[model samples]
Target: MRGVARTTAFLVAAAFIPIIALAQTPAGFEFQITLSKQAAQRLASSGEGITVQASYYGEPKKGAEKHVDEMGQIYLGDERIDLPGKAATARINGSGFEQAAVKWLDGPAMVNVNIFSSRKAGPDNILSCDLIDGELQVVRKSRFAVHCALIEEGMQTELKP
Candidate 1:
């Protein structure tokens, strides 16, 4: 039993020596891919049953801009309204959707999302909406708000058709 235990310990230590040696030597390489807001928007917009296109960083990205036939419905509160323009804006007409149009910018990524109005259900307020995969997701969080200063994780359109 002792011999077996010693052998196991020896094997484990020997196996780890190579890893420890490798850790001491640093392997460094620099590779980067850059995408602008328009490119990201175009990618996120191609989900299905939606038409979303964006031009950013002097480059434009396009995807399946076709509207998916069977998309989930979003129930935007009466207070939250989408404004028409290249720079989209959501206005909160009342407290119900007051925070819906907040925009948050983190590093190279910008997020725009709108919150649907909340309805008071028996005990809790319900903000109801199904986010269709390919539907346009506008970043409506406020940039000035706290905890919004870091680079955000964004979803890009898949390269596949």
Candidate 2:
């Protein structure tokens, strides 16, 4: 009788393995871009007159708690842009979403910022990133529109489990 009970328990556990694996879902977004030659030249000419800004938004899965976490970096001509010590970093929490926007001047000749969130705990969450936008100015005289596009939309997953 004991051997039969043990076999029955093993079968029951095995049956639920797939369900558990399918329950958890991964969530996040990635944004990347390549600057055009003209844009790069304009930035270089601007010298200490250029500025960059970035923002993000996200929603937590059902029954999951929310938290604030984000990271951003800029590169010009394939080289990392050095940020000033006084640069401001923003973080938002609660409200079922998160957002951050930072601005800095006198950056590199050409630049692109890659921003992404850290993994959150729980399932059924969704993350969406908007286009990063800003402006480029030369000696505070000429102003030009600057922006980044999503070269890749990122992986797709089912909306519902």
Candidate 3:
């Protein structure tokens, strides 16, 4: 009976090994990028026609949390934000690329992001923030500090009432 009990304990621990490993995998990156008031308005009214080309720069900011789900949905904590087909791509290292399903939460001054599965943070990272809402592919702001870190992704985008 004692041997049987020991075997059960061993099996339970082994069963949990995969679960522990899965948790450590990086889900995505959350970035809080500053944009001007007019820029914010332009992005908001773009109607899912927006995409940013931000690169990993400097150290990660401490104030952000995971705002995008694995299903590529955006949220603010428990409440979700609506942005359908908002998934887009962001390039890094000038030419090298990664596919990211982007969704944002913007206001009068800033734009928060969940660019799916980005590269690790490092210096000398220059980001070109191309706001494609309008006809021109102009990058509105340059030298904006990217505040961000890796975070787990999950949540559904809900329309604001």
Q: How many steric overlaps are in each model, in order? A: 22, 0, 1
- Per-residue lDDT, model 2, residue 77, is 17
Q: Model-by-model lDDT, in order?
A: 0.20, 0.22, 0.24
Error of 2 at 110 (Å): 27
Supply the TM-score for candidate 2: 0.20
Clashing pairs in 3: 80-158
Better of 1 and 3 by TM-score: 3
TM-score of 1: 0.17
Q: Which prediction has more favorable lDDT, 1 or 3?
A: 3
**Which lDDT value does model 3 have at 156?**
19
Q: Model 1: per-residue lDDT, tens digit, 57-146?
A: 111123322311133212212222332211222222223321222222111222223222222212321121112111112222211111
Please give, for residues 1-161, the per-residue lDDT of candidate 3 as tens digits. Answer: 11122111100101111233223322222222333333233334443232333331111123332544453333222111222112222222112111122224222112233322122222222222312211011222221222111121111121110
At residue 134, give the lDDT of candidate 2: 28
lDDT of 2 by residue, 1-161 (tens): 11222111100101111222212311111122223333233333433121223222223323323232332232211112222111112111112111121122123222223322211222221222223322211111221221211123332211100
TM-scores of all candidate predictions against the true structure = 0.17, 0.20, 0.21
Model 2 CA deviation exceeding 4 Å by range: 1-33, 48-56, 60-161
